[model samples]
Target: MLRTRIITALILAPIVIGILIYAPKPLMGLFFLLCATACLLETLSFMLPAFENRLAGKHVDTIVTKASGETHTKIFAPETRRPMLITVGLAWCMFLLMIFGGAEGAFGSLVAGILATIMVGCFLADDVQLGAARSISMVFSLAYSVLPWVAVWQIYLMAPHSRYILLVVIIVWCGDTGGYFGGRMLGGKVFGDRKLAPKISPKKTWEGAVCGLLLSIVV
Candidate 1:
């Protein structure tokens, strides 16, 4: 499934990017908005897993101790989007856009709105009971959803040849590839008994991460 997702992302990125470069600003905006909405929808649904709800007496709240030693039980109440952080983020971002929605307002406001949205999402989802959910919904959502949309917007500003955006996708793909094949092939046993992340992803080794870093530098 991971391989399939990676492949799908790789294949569809170029198609979406091609449309962004070829289409008008309004159309390009529509394309990115769809992507952003899908990402946000998926990110928000992580908290209320179907199987998780069936489990009785399972408290999914994460406890965090602040620098001042005050404990905070952060409950990710994903019952609905009415009062959760996801809706809070969506409303805030749209509010920002609405605030700057005017004939005289520069196009920069839209870009700023997206960035601020991602920033707010990351901040609101600081403490999480599930590591996978936290990374995909909060951390990865911020970067993946916001940055790609930002890049497409940037391409609208520099149309006709938005190959630089393709470069970004290529760099990530190559780095991921290197991490997978290189680690399994060359990496013998760097992290003997130490687990990187047993809960979220048990197979991701330190060597794999280092290999990705090196591949990124090359890219």
Candidate 2:
């Protein structure tokens, strides 16, 4: 797994650097937008596996309209993929709209509006199959994966010529590397023998976290 991660990083680093340093603002924003969409899909799938399934067919039986034109249903398979796609689509639409709607001065408001749109989408997608828990997870995961990228874009727009963006990226990568190596080397030692969140992530350790922090500071 570590080797795979390293390889992936090696392959992506140059492309990401090129984009961050040389690409135009619109291109950079678009690249991160695509990444955010992929992250949203992956996070939703992790929370609800059915979300990743291809849309085989839309079963009309899933919803039935009555004479009063009211749709009613008691139990039905979740329209996971469709609803998730729609929700994500709505979020991105709002994101783009905000980006073009006075980004020069209202960056924070634009981000808030985009995030609000995503939250609304999550609530609207809540249903029997896509329970509230899963819906909330989707919202959190989207925020987790997308917000940092948005911040990077914001920094770029705010400081187009500054190398601080590159510095931040380097620090993040250094921290990740330090944590991985530190955990492997020190996590099982009697002196520092413990996991950080054993129930959630058996491989994480306080030692690793400290190493990460130190490395980030040094970088």
Candidate 3:
């Protein structure tokens, strides 16, 4: 697993670096837009699996109640994936586009767009069992996994803050490396045999966390 992670990182590192260093503003914005879209989709898969299945065109079993107080079973067909992606993905893209266009009211327009999208999603949900979960996930996914990428893009556009953004990235990389190595070296041996949060992450250790914090500070 470790070897696979390293190999994957080696393959992706150059592509990420090249985009960060050489891509023009528009291309850079596009890169983050794609990243945010992928993250949003992945988050939805975990937070609202039913919604993901629906988007993938799977027929979902649902029950309906008629006015006569009788219930019937039904299989609801899925919607087109591409159209949904394009529709929802455009919200993030529009925000990036507005930043690139340097509009004075970009933030306001983005907020309005987000609100309108959320409202539409909530109103259109037909399955009561999954509707609230999916609707809440839609809003949370945008704020959690999507907006941070948009913030990074905004930071990159600022010539002065761009270097600081790179520094932050380097710091995070250093912390990750420190944590992995430190845990391997001192975790089970020197830091007592007990595991930190054994139910969650069996490999994490207090010593490793401290080492990561120190490395990040040094970076």
Candidate 4:
């Protein structure tokens, strides 16, 4: 997995760097918009199944009995298409607003409007718990997948634009790469098997996190 990640990054780095360096502002914005859309879709896809399970009051794996009296565990498949499409469409609309309507008052107003719509819809749903779950999931997806790219787009519009973007990219890449390698190499050496978040990410050690932070700072 690490080797594949390295190889993929090597292949894509030049293309991404070239785009950042030479592409026009609109093209850059469009590129990031596509990225944001993909991220939003992925976020929704991941969370939708969890939301469905929560609404159904089922665990990640639920045991079901067949007519023949055989019991088997079933994993819920995400019913993500409708929600993903709608959320991605809204994300695109938000990007367009940023482009034409400007990223100041208009962007804020649109986000507010979206959130208000979500709240109203949730309020009117027959299942209040399900509606609440959907509201939380969608809000998180939008914030996580869309907001950072919007910030990056805004940064790209600043003076020394591409340079700023490149700096951000490099720092993030260095941190990620450093963390992976550091964790693999020296995970248990520094902290005596201490983990950063054992429940959430068992392999993530304090040592690796520190190394990544140091690498980011140096880079």
Clashes of each: 0, 0, 0, 0
How do the residues 1-219 of candidate 4 rate in per-residue lDDT, one tens digit apiece? 978997999899999898898898788878999999878876776565567567745343334556444333232233445455666777787777776666675568466747853774375345767667666667777888988888888788775549899999999998998898888899899889779998667789887898899999999
Off by over 4 Å in 3: 1-15, 50-87, 101-106, 127-130, 160-162, 189-194
Candidate 3 per-residue lDDT over residues 63-156, each given as its tens digit? 4456444322232224423323533565566566566656466677667656765665656566553445455556666677777776786678
Candidate with top lDDT is: 4
Model 2 residue 206 distance off true place after TM-score fit, in angstroms: 1.6
Compare the candidates by TM-score and give the number of the best one.
4
Relative to the unseen true structure, what is the C-alpha lDDT of residue 45 in candidate 1, on a scale of 0 to 100?
A: 50
When sorted by TM-score, best at the front, the candidate numbers are 4, 3, 2, 1
Candidate lDDT (C-alpha), each: 0.53, 0.63, 0.64, 0.73
Q: Given candidate 3, what's the lDDT at residue 164?
A: 54
Q: Any runs in candidate 1 off by more than 4 Å, and if so which?
A: 1-17, 47-78, 84-148, 155-159, 193-195
Q: In candidate 4, how many Å is residue 178 off?
A: 2.4
Residue 3 CA error for candidate 1 (Å)?
8.9
Prediction 4 TM-score vs. true: 0.78
Provide the clash count, candidate 1: 0
Clashes counted in candidate 4 amount to 0
Error of 3 at 8 (Å): 6.1
Candidate 2 off by > 4 Å: 1-10, 46-78, 102-142
TM-score of 3: 0.71
